[model samples]
Target chain A: MSAPPLPRTSAEPLVPVLAIVGVGLIGGSFAAAVRQSGLVTRIVGAGRQGGTLARAQALGLIDEIVSLQQAAQTADLILIAAPVGATTEILATLQPSLRPETIVTDAGSTKADVVTAARQVLGDQVGQFIPGHPIAGAEATGPEAADAQLFQGRSVVLTPLAENSNASKALLTRLWEACGARVVCMEPDTHDTVLASVSHVPHLLSSIYMWQVATAQDSDLRMALAGTGFRDFTRISAGSAEVWRDIFLSNRPAVLAELQEVKAALARAEQALIDGDGAALEDFLERAALARRLWGSRSGLA
Target chain B: MSAPPLPRTSAEPLVPVLAIVGVGLIGGSFAAAVRQSGLVTRIVGAGRQGGTLARAQALGLIDEIVSLQQAAQTADLILIAAPVGATTEILATLQPSLRPETIVTDAGSTKADVVTAARQVLGDQVGQFIPGHPIAGAEATGPEAADAQLFQGRSVVLTPLAENSNASKALLTRLWEACGARVVCMEPDTHDTVLASVSHVPHLLSSIYMWQVATAQDSDLRMALAGTGFRDFTRISAGSAEVWRDIFLSNRPAVLAELQEVKAALARAEQALIDGDGAALEDFLERAALARRLWGSRSGLA
Candidate 1:
C-alpha cells in the first residue's frame, strides 16, 4: 500500500497547499488522486471529528490533519467534499481566512444548495467557488473505501457561476481530467434536475423496493433467493444513509417529479394487468425496453 | 458449435425427451441445458417461425426442429418457453398428441397467466402441467445468445398446480437442477406477486426513466454522459421489448400495486424537494438506503 508506483510523471506545477474538508470517501479519494497524480506538493485534510482526519492522514489520504481555520488559511484550494447539508457550516468556518486567490470548490451531489451556501458565507467572493460534483463513488464509505481510481472513466459536472474566473474553472476542469474524469459544464439547476432523475430517484426506488422485500413475511426465503437482478437493482440502496438522506432532502423536487412519472407508467401497466390487456402491457414494456436499449447502446453501456 | 461439449455423463437414464417450444434465448438455453446435463435423450424444438428453428438447429441449441404435433407426440416433457400470450395456443396445438406421462412446464415470467392459459387448453390434463420460471437471462436474444450455463447459480421458481403429481414435480425439479439451477417452490399467486415487486416493477420503472431521458431535449448529451449508475438502473430496460410487454400484461395487477406504492414514495420525495425539505429528503434516502443495504447484504450482493 506504499503508494502503488506512480502511473505518470509529475510534470504539472505543484499545488503548494491543498485542503480537503470532511475527508471521507470523496475527500479521501480526491486526496489520494492528487497524491497519485503527483500534482500537489502538500495536502491537509480537516474533519469535524479529529478521528476521521487522523485516519485519513494515517492511511496516506492526506499528509497533514489540521483545523478548518488553519487549512483554510494556508491552502491554495479548499475542497469541500462533505455531505451537502454540511457545506454551509464548513463554508462559514472557512470564510474569515478565505484568500482572494484560493479556489473553493465542492464535490457535493446537489449544486444549487452548495452554491447558495457559498454565496451566503462568502458573498461576491463566491466567484472563487466552483460548484462541481464528481459522478463517481462506491456503495462503501470512509477513507478506507477511497480509491485513487474512483473517478476514472466517470463524468464530473461543473456548475460555474458567471463571476468565476476562467483560470479557476480551467484549473478545476484540468484537475478533474487529471483524475481521469470527463468534465461537462452544466447549469446548477439543470444539473440538480438531471442528477435527481438519473441518480437520487433511482436510489430512493431501490431503497423502497428493498424495504418492501424486507417487510415481507418470508423475508429470509426472499432474501436467500435474491440474486444478481435484485443486487443490481438495489446497489444504490447500499449508499450511506445519512449522506443519501441529506441528498434526498436537498433535491426532493426533481426526485419527486421523476417518481411521479414512473408511477403513472406503473399504474398504466397495472390497469392492463387487471383488465387482462396483454397488448397494452406489451406496448408499455416495449416502449420502456426500446428507450433503455437506445440509451444504453448510445452510452456504450450495452 | 458441435453441440458445445455436453457437461454431464451420458450414462444417466430414463433421460427425458424435452420438447422446447420456442428455441430462442429461453428455449434454446433450455435445449442446451438439457444437452449439457445429459438429462434428456433428445431436445426437439418447435417454432412456428422457420428462421428460429434453423438457427436453433445450426447453433446445436436443439437436436431437431419438429412440428408441434410431432414434438408433443414423442416428448416426455413439453416446455412451453414461448411468449405468455402464445402459450395457450401452443398448448392447444400440442394437447391432441400429449401423452399421459408428459410433464409440461414453462419459462414464462408470470405464472398465474400461464397456469390459467394451461387450464383453458389442457382441462383435466392441467394436472400434468408445472408452471416454472428460471430467473435467468441476458439482454441478448435468440438461439445464438443461448448458453447452457445461463441457469447456473440462478433460481428457478416452480409453481406446481394442486393436481400435479409428486413424481412430475420431482422430475421438473431435477431437470432444473440438472440445468444448474437452485429450485424454489411457491404458490403461483405468491410467485407472481413476489416477481412483480422485485422484477416486473423495476423493469417498468427503468423504462419510464429511460423514456424521460430519451425524450429529453438534450438526449444525446444525457445519453453520452450516462454512466454505470444509469446503465445499472436501466439494464433490464434493454431486454426484449416483446417478451417484457407480455410479462407486464400477464402480471399487471401485482405490478400495478407495486407501482402504486413506489409512486407514492416517489411523490413524497417530489413534495419534499418542492418544499425544500432537506431533512425529509435525507430521511427518505436514508431509510431506502438502509433497507436496500440490509436486503442486499443478506442476499450476499454487498
Candidate 2:
C-alpha cells in the first residue's frame, strides 16, 4: 500500500491521524487541544476500558475509538497516556504494528523509565518514541474532565532520545506549541530527577500526610476543622492513585533521594522545636517563606 | 469610672467601640467584616508598627490607631489578633485599663496557648477573655489583603473559660455570627489538638518541603518545572514566618505529636517503595485519595 508522507513541520493539519491511549485527563485534554488547534484531522483513542474511549469520543476529544494495534498501524503519531507502569506492555503491543514513519510520544510523569521501556521494546525503532510530560493536572480525572484549554500556558517537557530524528523533534515541538504549551527539551535522567523533587516526591508526601490525618482517632473533627490551607496542601493527594503509584515506583531512586532531603529538613525543624530555639525556628521558616513568596509572585499565582 | 453595660444579645450594633490589636489580615478582616455587619460602631487598630495601623486605618478597617491601654479602656470588645507569642504582653497591657464589662477575645490559630497566656495575665479577669480561633486564613497578609467577606461561611472556635459568664459567651457568639462565621464551642486543649492535626502541622510540613526544594542543588530547574500542584502544596509555606514560628512554638506539643505521626506514615510509604510493594503503596494512596476527594466534595471546593 502506498501512503502520502506525513508533514514534518508546523503546518495546518500537522497530524493526519493522531492516536491517544488511555483517554483520561491528560490524554483526553491532548486530543481536545490538538483538535482545536486544527493540527490533527482525526484522533483515535484507545484505552484498557471501552467506556473511557467511548466517553472521549462523545466529548469530542477523539474522532473514533480504536484498538492499540489499529492506532499504531494507522496513525502518524500515537500518544500513550496510560499510567507509567503500563508503558512496557503498551510499547510491546504497538511495536508489531508500528510504522517506521509514526512518531510515538507519551505523557508519563517520569521520563527515564518510559524511555527505557521504549528502548527495550522497540529495539531499533526506539527513535520513534519521544518521552514527554505535560506539567499540568487537576484533581479531577477521566474523559469528562478534559478541556481544550488545559495546556494553555503550561510547560511540556520532551526528553528526546539520541536515536530520535530532528524532523520528528521539530514536528512534536510545533504540535505542542499549537496547543499553547511551552515545550522544553532535556535529558531523560535530568527530567526524572527534577520532576522527582518538584512533583513526584511532593505527591508522595501529600498522600502520606493525608493518610495520617484520615487514619487519626479524631479524623472526623480534624476534617471538620480543616480550612483552605489544609485543603490546598492536600489537594495533590486526591490525584489518581494508580497513576501516582506508577510514577513513584518508576522514579523510585530520585524520589527516595528527594524524600531523604525532606526528612533532613523536617529533622532540623524538629530539633529547633525541641530545643525551644525561637530564633533558629524563625530563621528556618523565614527562608522557606521568602522563597515561596518570591516564586508565587514571579509565577503570577495570586 | 463607671460605664453602661454592653449588649449581650444578637442585636444590631452590638459593639459600640471595637478594638483590633495587630490589624493584619485576621484583625483587619475582622474589623471590616464586623463593621459591614453593622455590629461595630468604631474599630480601633493597634499594632507594634505604626505603618501597619495607619494602613489599616486608611483602608477603613479601623476608625483610629490607639495604644493598647486606650483601646482597653474605651472599647466594648478587644480582639488581640497579634501573634501568639505576643499574647502575654498584649493581655498584660490591657489588664490594667480593662473595663469590667469589656469582652476580650482572640483570633489566634492555637487556643490552649493563648488561653494559658490570658489566664496568666488577666488573673481574676480571665473570665472576660474568650479564647477563640478563626479557622480561616490566606497566603496574603496585611491591611491590603483584608476582605469583608473573609469570614463568611467560615468556622470560629470559642474556648470559653469556666470563669466566664453566660452573657459574655452569648455576646461573643452573636458578634462572630454577625460577621458571617459559624461559631463552635470546644475546650482549649481540644481546639489545639484538632488544629495541630489540620492546620499547624500541615503548615510546618509545607514549609519544610518548600525549604528542601528551594535549597536543592538544582533548585532553579526544579522551580522552573514546578506547576500548579507544587504551587498549591507550598502556598501555605508563603505565610508570615514570624506568625508560624509563634504558632509552632505555642502549640509545640501538639504539632510535635502530629509531626511524629506524619513521620511514621512516611516511613511506611518509604518501606513500601523500598520493597517494591506496589499493592501496599496503591492501598495507602487509594485511602488518602478517597478521603481527600470526599472532603473536597463535601466542602464545596472545586
lDDT of 1 by residue, B174-280 (tens): 77888888888888898888888778877776766676667667666666666667777778777787788788778877887767766666566566667877677
lDDT of each: 0.79, 0.89
Report the number of the highest-TM-score candidate. Answer: 2
Across B1-302, the per-residue lDDT of candidate 2 in tens digits comes to: 11136554445577889999999999998988888777778889887989999898888889999999899999999998988999999899999999999999999888887887888888898999988988999999998999888888888998888898887788788778778888888998999999989999889989999999898888889988899899989999999999999999999998998889999999999999999999999999999999999999887653
Best by lDDT: 2
In Å, residue A228's CA in model 2 sits off its true spot by 0.5
lDDT of 1 by residue, A1-302 (tens): 01122324576554778999988989999888878777788999897878888898889888888888898789999889988888899988888888888999999999888887888888978898999999887788899888998888788999989988877787777678779888889898888888877788677777766666666676666666666666777777778877887787777667676667656655665666788776775666676677777666665556
State in Å the error of residue B286, model 1.
3.0
Which runs of model 1 end up more than 4 angstroms from their true locations?
A: A1-9, A257-280, B1-10, B267-283
